[model samples]
Target chain A: MKARVYVTLKPSVFDPQGKTITDALQSIGYAGVEDVRQGKYFELELATTTPEATRSMAADIADKLLANPVIESYRVEVV
Target chain B: MRFGIVVFPGSNCDHDAYHAAKHVLGQEAELLWHKDRDLKGSDCIILPGGFAHGDYLRTGAIARFSPIMQSVKEFAAAGGPVLGICNGFQVLLEAGFLPGAMLRNRSVRFQCEHVFVRVEQTDTPFTLACTRGQVLKIPIAHGEGNYFAAPGVIEQLERERRVIFRYVNASAEAVESANPNGSIAAIGGICNEERNVVALMPHPERACELALGSSDGLVIFESVIQAIRSGRCAATLRHAQGRPEPSRGASPPAAALVQ
Candidate 1:
């Protein structure tokens, strides 16, 4: 089984890397982009075959290690 | 007083901290390896800065589970004083000894320069040697030193006088340009609620000698030594001890910008 974890800075938190990307986009003549935010993606190999179990375990892993709850939020999906 | 410097595998500043404590300050110091479960009866602990676990996941995420951290946690729980500098500060946050998280620098650049930090609180174990509102010019080298916390928590830290240091200009005002990493409140260092554990972004150990640019950082090491040797309680009870009171009325301008 494979699980995916997505980590992103909360809306209230500032994302400097994302803003730089936005600036790069503007320099390349792109427009109409309201905002850009950067985040991390993690794909995990799990031993569990159950989707429910994998999702719960991935969420727990994300909470404990993949993301810092203070400034980042995380979502998990089992595939 | 015996100072224990925890040396994780990637910790580069452990020797600097050991030298500051031993050669410079004439205090007993030892380096505790990452896998060591014992604190070796150290009166105080210093977490030295480096790319712990190669900073794979997040800065301090992997180092938090190092074998030595359990002992460090117990030591802090027993009211032992601990100072975390730079990457050490990241470790303390991951270990849950300090509040807030380190975000990427707002400029998205690795900043390595001398910056001024105004001492906001002078009564904690780490700042006892510093006078209130005194600015110390120190060098900061990091990309993820921008400290962030929830708005309510930031308010509480300010109210409790836990903000020990704030980035500031020469005039001791925390202006936007003075902020090296866009830390909320321009916070350069902070103490735990009990005041025993402190996490600072600047490298104090590197500044202990005259050749290192500024010796202002020596005061922090001196304060820790004095605190442990004087038989004073490291943890301030309810934070009601005699703290210098100007911070309540003289909140820094950058702090207001975040709110």
Candidate 2:
């Protein structure tokens, strides 16, 4: 199973990289850009056999190592 | 004073902080690895500046979960003094031990230069030796040093006098123009509500030596030492020895505002 995880700074944390990208895009003639926030995507090839097990393990990764629960949030999808 | 500089992966300034505490101030300082849970009997814990984890996920985002941070947070909760410089400041925000957050520099490039900062408060151990409104010339090197917090939180910080440092010009009188990274209200550093933890973007240790052109940063380290020599830091030390936090009023709720 493949687990794709998306990580973003929690709404409470500031996203400086996102702000810089937004400004750059605007300067490059991108229009109608109201706001921008950056996030990360991770594709993991799970060693677990069962899809259920993969999903559970992915949560563990997000909670323990993949993302900081305090300042960031993460979502995991199995395929 | 017993000091411990946290060494996260890719931390280049751990040695700088160690030297500032040991060589500059003539105190005992040690390096604590990211994976080590032991703080090793330190009274003041410093989170040094550097591209920790290469700032891979985000500035300080990846390093927030390092094993050493757990102890660092515990140390701060115990009222021990904690100083976070540059990337270390970002780590403190990521760890939620301090308020506010860092965003990319308004210039969107790595900014490395000496800037002036005005001391606004001297109540905390970090700035106890500083006279109010004194100016400091220190170097700031970071691509994401812009500080952002909501307007309400900003007001609260101001009201509590937690906003301890503001970027200024060489003259030290002018504001805004000295804003290197567009930090809100020209803020260069701030402390927590209790004022026990401080995080700043400038590198004070880098300017401690006479050859560095300015010894403005030396006073900050000296302030820490003075704080230790006095009984003011004893409460922090007692907390580190596992004494329960005095049941004073609950700590104010932390507010977050990211621009």
Candidate 3:
């Protein structure tokens, strides 16, 4: 089984990198860009074959290790 | 006092901490490898600055799982005095020893310079030697040093006097321009409610010598020694005496924001 995890800063947290990217995009004539928030994506291969089990395991990993609960939130997708 | 400086694989400031403790402060000091489980009966434990675990994933993220951290956690739970500086501060936050998180500097660049930090609370073990509102000059070097937390947490920290340091100007005013990394409320350091664990973003060890352009950092070390000598660190001493451990609980939530 394979899993994908998306980690993003919470809405209340400041995103400096995202802000800079937004500025660069606007400078390049893409003035329509309003807000940009940077995040992390992780793809993992699990030895488990059960999709249900994989999803739970990935979510646990994301909560405990891949994401800091204080500043980040994560979503898990298993396929 | 005996100081134990934990040296993670990528730690670059371990020697600086050791030198500050052993030479500058004239105290017994030892470097404890990250893999070691024993604290060697240290009176104080220091997690110095460096790119621990190569700062992969996130700063201090991977390093928090090192074998020694378990021991560090236990030591702290027993009310031992633990000081985390710079990258060590990030580790403490990740490990849940402290509240909040670090973000990239608002300028989006690595910063390395001496800045003024005003002493906010001197009742804690780490600042007992300094007067409240005294300013110390210390150097900070990091790309991700901005500190953030929820608003409620900030209010609680303020109500309990957990905030210990704030970036400030030469005259000890916490002006906007003086904040180097955009830390909430210009916080440079904070301690748990028990005052046993402290985390600070500045490198006091690097500023302990006059030849290093500042000796102001010595006050912090002196404060710790004074705390120990005066038996103010009753919890840690009680643990050292093999008394029954006190009940432990999670630190209260804290928050801060600079207007």
lDDT by residue (tens digit), candidate 2, B126-233: 999999999999999999898888788889988999988999887776566789998889989999977889989999989888887778898988888766556455
DockQ value for model 1: 0.81
DockQ of each: 0.81, 0.27, 0.76
Error of 1 at B230 (Å): 0.3
Backbone N/Cα/C clashes per model: 0, 3, 5
Off by over 4 Å in 3: B238-259
Residues B126-201 of candidate 3: C-alpha lDDT, one tens digit per residue? 8989999999999999998999889998888889988899999999999999999999999899998788899899
Error of 2 at B11 (Å): 1.1
What is the TM-score (0 to 1) of candidate 3?
0.92
Which 10 consecutive residues of model 2 chain B have the lowest summed lDDT?
B250-259
Tell me the TM-score of candidate 2's A chain: 0.90
Alpha-carbon RMSD to native, per candidate: 9.0, 7.8, 7.0
Q: What's the C-alpha lDDT at position A30 in model 1?
A: 89
Best by lDDT: 3
For model 2, what is the alpha-carbon lDDT of residue A78? 93
Off by more than 4 A, model 1: B233-259
lDDT of 1 at B139: 91
